[model samples]
Target: MVFGFLTSRRRAGLRAQPVPPEWRQIAERNLAIFRRLSPADQEELLQHVQVFVAEKHFEGCGGLELTDEIRITIAAQACLLLLHRETDYYPRLRSILVYPSGYTAHGEHHVEGGIWEEAAEDRLGHTGQRLRALVLAWDSAKHGALDPTDGENLVLHEFAHQLDFEDASTNGTPVLESHAEYLAWGRVMNEEFEALRSAEDAGEPTLIDQYGTENPAEFFAVVTEAFFERPHALRRRHPALYERLASFYRQDPMRFVPIEQERERL
Candidate 1:
């Protein structure tokens, strides 16, 4: 794909700066999956993180103050989604509002028959509908990074939502490179979506969380978490699902080896 460049690829127009040594240490210390990547991928991720941090505005909420550690950690996770891809740095992203932990919000949703439903929910993260900004829980984001096999990650999930929303909708589909890709996506995703819905209804053991059956948007976000955190499990039990996600993300988390090596490296 002519989508973009990597430092290892050394493609023209890509001038990746060196990742700061201190930030490197912090990433290695806090992010397990990051260390599982090859050094070249690590360098790619670092440069992307630099771009993300430089471009995005991050404001701490709930009296929490921003710091390099928090910014680097979140930036590293967010940029991981952009690794080895052509991106405009989340073009519609305006800012990131992060709380120290899960926060509450009162909102309404569009329901069937054009009715509006009001509800209050506790959320770890949410993407903006107005193309303005996104929200996150720093504690959950940090926890998500520290563990790589939990099948839950706020950053990956939320950023994946951002990817989906580039089209101004959260319908479990992102922009595809081709129409053929779109056909393939619907085939794979719809089949998996129905299967997950059935599993949830039967209360069957599922590699996908029951929450995924809530809707296609939630399915995309939930699977994003599984694809990164529990790659092996997702691959083992849902190979087709894993394949589709790998194709979209343009990277395979399962291909990286020695899951525990990242923890031991420090």
Candidate 2:
């Protein structure tokens, strides 16, 4: 219904139809994330991922080919969030603009001498700029995706921004159903946000990313990264925070991740 948003018809059209075994093979090969999902969840997600990839247009930003692997990897991660919600949850988002690797944004800044440097600003795509819902393949976007501990998974991080924007402000609160829930959400999230900010300000390392201390919105996005990538740790460190996120997401990834881990061990 909103401009720049895709219609349900368009989304229906993009639904992953019967794909050849090759595409599934490609998706499994590049998407460690796909393997993390349960079988039923995987099939459901695959359907959504198909439609998601079909509906959004992809352009090669850095001379890289928009291969099936790239599309699947991006779709797989994005669809991971939707595993617990409906496609309409992302109805506000239409296109997914991805980069081969990390990109930079240039801006102006002020100096102490009251002089402004025209090129004083240097920011990684993940670290700066909040526009143009970006899904970057960090490996290709910047230095490649091999480093799991770079404190940056651009795809996961920025898509979390898209989720944050659903509440209309990137201030960490997303669109919840009712006013009472909204009140509870504000109280819980603000408390958690304060804890993260205080921990970082005190120069103590916290399980959550320190960058989350940057602001409420950053707190939402960064904590979301912790949610998907490290659900158990989030639950262990902040049980209330984990519970609220599980409620909002409608999926107890803390439960799902462990089930997934157990399956793998077996």
Candidate 3:
């Protein structure tokens, strides 16, 4: 089949070329999230990153030009989500569009008196457009990768949206490994979604971003930011949600880090 041939060719590419020194240096310099992976995951992630960079197109917007730093940095952060999982290389994703900073998109929104109006919403990043393009703010993306514990990564957040959209819907649920897992996913996620909604309604603080309360779809994207960036804090705050994410991502990120970095040094 064509799929098998493409996959075989991809494997051949990864084997044919070791990650270039320059790309490796760039990845090492930028990926604090990379340190949060186990050694095996880290190595595998590098391979995936290489494939991703080669496969996806990177285009600049707002007069910002593309460079290796931009490509590798985005590729490194984006591919981390695919680590430890069999993936189709974000089949829906075709290209990345980078803006120098926040960009505006025209859309309808309710303003004064709850009247609908056309407005321009400035965003750090956006996805869900035709051609499966992801638009990111370069500075935001870099700064997010620089601070691993902030629990907000533009790249991770958008890529999470990509994963969720793979099902032809933007629901919070991703495809699980088994039917039972799907049932458990619905139960646990709905319970947590309700809790978050309650917290928001009561004007109480939530460990996850308030944006997550928007809907199940946004909840999945927002928690993905927490799951990878603030694993320890997420575990302390919402143990069940953290457990489900860890189970789904196959990563106990808190345990994978600092130790992995130390081992790399030894």
Candidate 4:
């Protein structure tokens, strides 16, 4: 109890601190979505960013140097998930490891019965329930930040995994507020998951990424990317899925201008 109280106090203090000019500048320059947020949401995000930056450790891997720019940029995106919601700041996540670009991850894969093969795969980001860490490629992270409408975001994808991990399982469903909410989430998510899988099997174009068909967990993460980055398209194609995400996230991203339209204005 004492520890929890102290941690909350510390975070409250961090959130209350004034936003450093450099931090503000870094967020504005690197996070395009930050520019589109309402004033209230922007302030909420900055506060979350402050607490997240103070709590999470960031390390640059593969000979890259870590900077405030990188830290703030990543934190801004991760905290974007926390906006307008009660949050523990991705309670299970502790460290963020960033590489200069896509890095090779080596692991063992099951090739057949009782046999495993070692393999290396290039990845932009990764997170798992046991790891308590997020791995990201800085270049991809920057690109995702710069192009928030792209429907793919490294930080958001991995952090969605982090949220999935919060319930002690990496299932498509996070911790919903009630049993009724859980029922709704399961029904909608299962239907959408099956739809995506069927679409993939039939070779039809899909708005929710074919990768979501990998499993329920990846479906959650992929839809989260679509929820934030391609809200209108997701809503148009899958209203129930979009409504579930908006209810869970407590943010209706359709309020923001489409990036294409914003570019046309420029």
Per-residue CA lDDT of candidate 4, range 16-43, in tens? 9999989889888999889989888889
Candidates' C-alpha lDDT? 0.81, 0.64, 0.82, 0.89
Residue-level lDDT of model 1, residues 77-167, one tens digit each, is 9889888877766767989998999998888877778899897889898886575788999999999989877777889888888888877
Better model by lDDT: candidate 2 vs candidate 3: 3
Clashes of 3: 0
**What is the alpha-carbon lDDT of model 4 when measured against the actual structure?**
0.89
Write candidate 2's Cα lDDT for 175-205 as tens digits: 7767887888888889988887788778887
Instruction: Give each model a TM-score.
Output: 0.87, 0.80, 0.90, 0.95
Query: Higher TM-score: candidate 2 or 4?
Result: 4
Q: Which residue runs of candidate 3 sit more than 4 Å off their true CA positions?
A: 108-116, 129-131, 257-266
Ranking by lDDT: 4, 3, 1, 2
**Per-residue lDDT of candidate 3, residues 134-198 (tens digit):** 99999999998877776678999999888887777889887678998888889889998999899
Model 1's TM-score against the true structure: 0.87
Which residue pairs of candidate 1 clash? none
Candidate 2 at residue 206, lDDT? Answer: 82
Question: Candidate 1: lDDT of 191?
Answer: 93
Cα lDDT for residue 158, model 1?
85
